[model samples]
Target: MSAADVWPIVKARLELLDDARKPLIETYIAEIEHRMKHYCNIRALPDNLLYVWASMTVDAVRVDLPNADEIADTVGGGANIKVGDTSVSGGSSGSGVTNTSKAVIDQVVLDYRVDLNRYRQMRWGG
Candidate 1:
């Protein structure tokens, strides 16, 4: 699909206006990794994830199965456990974690589910 086919349509709908286009990458899938930096805490990875984030656009796309052999080959098919309880209050927040210590993560999770359902609908021609 073309870039113009996807980019401009969603730009007008989103409210907050922060860019949301995730790059089609090969390094590893990006997850919000929070960490402590110099004096203040930073909620990001200390690597090339940010650079990969910008050179893309806010367009939804899909691809085939991953040839990923990283975790499955390295550790006998175990997945990493992400901490924090998914609570009634959404993700959780206190002092020095993520801005996601609030309701944003919760909403994002809900949005993800909705998107997944839409994908299923599109796949099945429903």
Candidate 2:
């Protein structure tokens, strides 16, 4: 399905009230489609996988949202506090380690492995 077909569902899933983020969501959907093409060896995603596609897109948006960095700094075991010239920093629960080489699609693939596997095309011969 084209981004136009999937945009409304994604917007609803995200509870978005306006089109301000439409372009960003569409970008994520396109990236997911590209990665799905490579990962599943399919020219296009099957219609049955629309929900999966939208869900993955939503996840991609959430992971890369503008405020994600701010949230990461204070949540999930990463925190810093300063009081009266004294400062203390808490150790991160490994969430601070970022692998820049990994694309957001990689995580989405892991997240939806079960669904994708159901439709994965097997490749054979060199």
Candidate 3:
């Protein structure tokens, strides 16, 4: 299957009903596929790895397009509260944010290392 075939599955996993973010999602899908190809040394993605690719794409999208504002709105916090001489501040747990030094794409690949290994093509040089 091609990357296009995985788009719908990624959308479904992300609960996306509209196509507003289609382009963005597609971009992530391409990058994920590229990394997978490089890591596994495979020319094309096998059908068995479709769901794995979709999952990695979903994770990258979630990290890059985190719904922080929506989450904060729903979980209300007081970041500007002050009481006399004392001051108090609070904010959303920021659980949606992933604190990682690695890029989202790299992290996705690393996260799916085992799955990708199954399809890896070994190479040897003289």
Best by TM-score: 3
Regions of candidate 1 where Cα sits further than 4 Å from its true position:
15-126
lDDT of 1 at 70: 20
Q: Better model by TM-score, 1 or 2?
A: 2
On a 0 to 100 scale, what is the lDDT of residue 80 in model 2?
Answer: 43
lDDT of 1 by residue, 95-118 (tens): 122334223333333334432232
Model 3 clashing residue pairs (backbone): none
TM-score against native, each model: 0.18, 0.69, 0.72
| Global local distance difference test of model 1 | 0.24
lDDT of 3 at 71: 20
User: Clashing residue pairs, candidate 2?
Assistant: none
lDDT of 3 by residue, 17-79 (tens): 677778877988999889999999889899999999998887666555554343233223654
lDDT by residue (1-126, candidate 2, tens digit) is 676778898878666777887776687888888777778888888898898888888666555552443323332243543222223343433332232213555776667888888888988877
lDDT: which candidate is best? Answer: 3
Per-candidate clash tally: 2, 0, 0
Task: State the TM-score for model 3.
Answer: 0.72
CA deviation > 4 Å runs, candidate 2 = 66-102
